[model samples]
Target: MKLLSFRVKKSHLLLVGILLVAANLRAPFTSLAPLLDAIRLDFSLSAVQAGLIQTLPLLAFALFSPLAGSIAVKYGIERVIFAALLLIAAGIGYRSYGGLFGVYGGTVLIGLGIAMGNVLLPSLLKRDFPQRVASMTGLYALIMGVGAALGSAAVVPLSQLSALGWNGALFAMLLFPLLAMAIWFPQLSHGAARLAIAGEPQQRSGSVWRAALAWQVTLFLGLNSLIYYVVVAWLPSILRYQGFSAEQAGSLHGVLQLATAVPGLFTGHLLARMKDQRAIAVTVSLLAAAGLLGLLALPAFATLWVVLFGIGAGSTIILGLAFIGLRSGTPAQAAALSGMAQCVGYLLAVGGPPGVGLLYDATHSWHGPLLICAALALVMALVGYLAGRDRCLTPAEPLNEGRLSEEER
Candidate 1:
């Protein structure tokens, strides 16, 4: 009885630790946009250069994500996660205090850490709680959304603190990862045993890369991400152009982020009940399209537009993460698919903000860029519908000697 009780307690603690880790993943990056102008002024950076700060992280995700699964295969997922948390903490410290080198170098560290966490978390969840993938994914998404919203919401206030300023504001975010690390430390001791219990299959399949459904999932994730980062990078500027104050714009940005999280509360149940997720996908895309249309046609209703867009963007992310698990038959495959999707997905996303800027620069108006994004939302609806289909990426057969096929690689 004591042993069973102890196991239950440990399970609860592990769940809490996973959620805490999720919370740390996004806040550090999302928190920065509100402070971008301040950082720019302090650093004497051009708009392109300031934009680079945002893009750099995505680039790191693109570069590092494909490698994350292999690293986990060799090092064990728990150790990789622990290393990632340390990297994030160290990166935050460097970025906030290290001057020019700190800015770029720290961003690289933070981005790589986030990329590893992002790739590993889905696999970890799928491995430990096979029956609860959607529920757990939704919970993680909900926490992540809250964390991002909090990060965005807090930046202005933190920066405003007389003694702390921008540097201190960025530095303050370090606490999240530190806290997560503390919670996660206990899990590391049993990492090998945990992997064994999860039945890490020896048969590796190289088939994910060749699967059509995998591409659909990848595109769904990529397009959704592209729309999100584009908005993240430019929404404040758009609001400002419509005559809102900087503070108002920043607050709205935070609100937008918060709205994205609202769906997380319900997505798990929704996903679990409906394997064919096309309706949800189409609905969210339309909401986003309507929001973007509102921005162009009725700038006065900025609040409504942002709220709608946020819901659409946030729901898509939930679906994207859920798809990574729902479509895979094994945890390793989930990790491989996740790594592939994020690698290509983020690579596609790296151009978004800069592209938005170039379009705005060329036309000298928000109308052109807004229209393009609205149309892309429609495209997302189409692609997401395809990805929403219930199917696995490959047959459930394990590969001989647990080796991935050269073609799949």
Candidate 2:
């Protein structure tokens, strides 16, 4: 009984820690999207060049995510996450306070920091909260969504309505990540990420890279990322093009991000109870499609459309992250799968903002790019079906290998 109590207390502590880490993930990036035009005007950059600011992080994610697992193995998950948060804090300050070089370089550093956390968080959950992966993932998404909502909603007002200009607004936005960094500091003593010897030997990194399930989850996550980051980068501009005020546009972007948080509260309940995730996964994509289609067809209902997209984007994100845990047999495989998926997933997303920018440059229209995203949402429906399977990484390994539940084995 005493041991069980201690384990429960530790679980709660880890839950708090993981959620705190999740909050810093997207807020930093979304906070800047509303300010992209301001930065562009200040820097004298073209649309394509300005778009690179958004692309740089995704590029960093693709390049650095694969390395996070190995780094964690060497240094420990807690230590690596601490360092990642430091990079995030430092990057936020530098980007906000410095000039053009600081802008690009700081964003890159922030990306690298975030990439480590992103890859490790699911693996951490898989290792620690083996019984409730889906539920915990939902909570993770919920907190992350709230943080992003605050960033998107507040930054424009801070920059426009307060004493803080764009730089000050961004600089001030560093507080959340700084606090998260501080919170993570104590976790260093937990030791580095290590592999467990499950019933069957854990599949190596190459097995994960070669697995069809991993690839499916990768595409599911990648396409969803493509949809999300594109909207994050261009939604403000898209709203402006549709004749909304800058403040209105920024507020709606916040609304969209806030809407994203709503599904996180329930996604866990659904994923936990449902036999498979195909239904929710497919519905989520269609919701995004309908929302984007509404954007093209009906500009007057922008709020509703944004909400739909947000919910879809948010639920799919939760599912994708859940898949990383759900599909892997061991935490090590989880990290390997996460690294590979995010690397390619982000690579698939890295081109979106710039491609949309160039498309807009060519046609002076947001319609084309939005339509393309809507079509991809359909593709996500199919990918969701495959990724939502009830299988594990090792076909014969019981789903309870980490927890070692005999019934499951």
Candidate 3:
């Protein structure tokens, strides 16, 4: 009954491909994070220019996000994903070996590829394996986290290998996407038609863009991301300035991502027990602030500080996702809120790297940037409280009432 084509269990191949793509979602960026200064130094990139390297992918993700879902609808998810893998591979290869054009161009492609994968994979999971959506989605998230951690950790070591410098290390990642493409290629012809999800018209009874609760959730998600990515893009350099060696800083960067993935293990249990998540939100945001301040005030304990920051950053990432579901009253509202939050949230993240870079460039000191993000972390705490209030995006229906969506059923 579960037979797919040619003795394949249909879902098995699909699951493999989906998981492969999930692992790739954050790997490309995390791999490059610790190597950012190397890239900057090699190209003589100004601080702001180096920041753009980090920002470009986020910018591209934001700009392309709204369109990816629709594009997948028309062309088919499998085909889009197939192409996305290709882009990611090409991006990595180009970014590693080529000149400036290759650098920025490659990042854009990676972003586009990641955007499609991030946007569509969950829907694909729901469509193909509705019964296992929750578990599959959790696995998907875990894979992304672990993949990112590995990428962050592995790059410096790989780059240190003779005849395979930073660019070579980046290029080595091509093997993953290439392998994924091979794993996924077998289904390219069979899937687009057989697994196609039926399309639905975009529904907006009231635009989530206009809702106050929507803005609160949006700001919370946005600010948290801004702080998180600032850390991702700059933590290594920040630590290095404090006299940690490249290897040590790189290891800690990996730790940050690994810690992020840890939250998934406990998130389900914690959320189930909480009546509302306001306290949770404030706690995480404060954790982030404390860690940031610790970085400045307690430089000797950088390891503890980074772990705290990592936990706080990781928690906020989950909180952002949870708020999307917790605050929406209807499925349609959730859909709209999701689109709005992600688009706006990533847009906010797009500015964080370069903005911090600009500060660093101006002041020639890390203290100002660290202090600024710490202050923003406090702001995230305030927004988290408002966003976490026990309220719906709109009173479309009551969340616990188990009402159907506003769209025609």
Candidate 4:
């Protein structure tokens, strides 16, 4: 009984550590946007060039995510996660000191770090909390929202500290990863015993790609991410163009990020109780659509539109994660499904910000880009409905031995 209790205590501590690490993944990336104008002025970059800087990490996410699964397979998730955090620290430190090349290189590293965590966290959650996937996903999303909000909110103030400068602002982000590392180091000490064994019995085949249900989940997550990051990269600038001060715009962006936590905390409960997740998905997407439309029609009301957008976008994010767990039969299956979804989904997602910027550059107006995103959100709604159904990926069966023997003979 004492040994069993000790095991339980250890498991709880590991879960806490994993979540802490997950929470730090996005803070560094998101925090930089609020201070982009200051950096651009200091560096003298064009709007398109600045957009490229903002887009680099996400592009890394698209490129690096597939590698995460293979890495986790070989190195153990806990070790990879710790290594990713250290890489993030190094990336941020480098960017804080280096010139333009350093900035871009550091950004790429941060993206790589985040991509590893993004791929591993869902799998870790599935492995650790099989029965509570939805709830745990909700918690993950909630903490992510908190991290994003804190990072976004702090950048302006941190940048103001004369001793720290913009470099200080970037370096300030190292604290979270450092804290998470301190918590995670003990799990690493446990060695292979703490790791999920490769080729375990639970790692069975499920025809995820062939399943329509799997596609739906992937599409929904992809679209949600595309829309979410587009806003993250551009919303402050968008609001500023619409007559708000840079400070006000940044604050509003932070608020929108904080609001993300609300739906994340509740969406899982709503989905678990309700038979249909489609309605919630559609509702959230439409809410986002409405916010975008409002921004187009009433740019002066940026704050109000952002609130609606946040609610819509946040709810969809929570629901998309819930579907990952709901659609898979086992933890390994969920991990495989998540890996497949994020791999394809982020590849599709990487296009959003740059594509929007290209359209803006071509048209010389936000109207065209806004319209395109709105339409995408509507399509996301339709796809989300199809994906959120209560179904799992079905595996193929082997042919009969008698028929195979006759053919071979």
Best by lDDT: 1
**What are the TM-scores, per candidate, against the unseen true structure?**
0.91, 0.87, 0.78, 0.87
C-alpha positional error of residue 238 in candidate 3 after TM-score superposition, expressed in Å: 4.5
RMSD of candidate 1 to the truth, in angstroms, is: 4.2
lDDT of 2 at 149: 75
lDDT of 2 at 37: 92
Candidate 2 accuracy as TM-score: 0.87
Write one digit per residue (lDDT tens) for candidate 3, span 1-409: 4444646665577788887888888899768877888888888999778867877888877888666656665676678788889989989988887789899999999998887776566546545654444345556677788887778778899999988988988987787788789889976886456433422323442356667677888788888888888887789999999999999997887677777788766654575566577998899899999999999998899888888887887777767766665666543344455556667889988888778888998988999999999999999999998787766654442232222247713
Give the Å error, residue 313, model 3: 0.8
The numbered model that scores best in TM-score is 1
Cα error, candidate 2, residue 400 (Å):
20
Candidate 1 error regions (>4 Å): 161-163, 196-206, 242-248, 395-409
Provide the global lDDT of candidate 1 against the true structure: 0.86
Q: Residue by residue across 128-232, what tens digits does model 1's lDDT show?
A: 888888888989999998888778778789899999999899999998899999999998997786665333652353456767777788888998888888887
lDDT of 2: 0.84
Ranking of all predicted structures according to lDDT, beginning with the best and ending with the worst:
1, 2, 4, 3
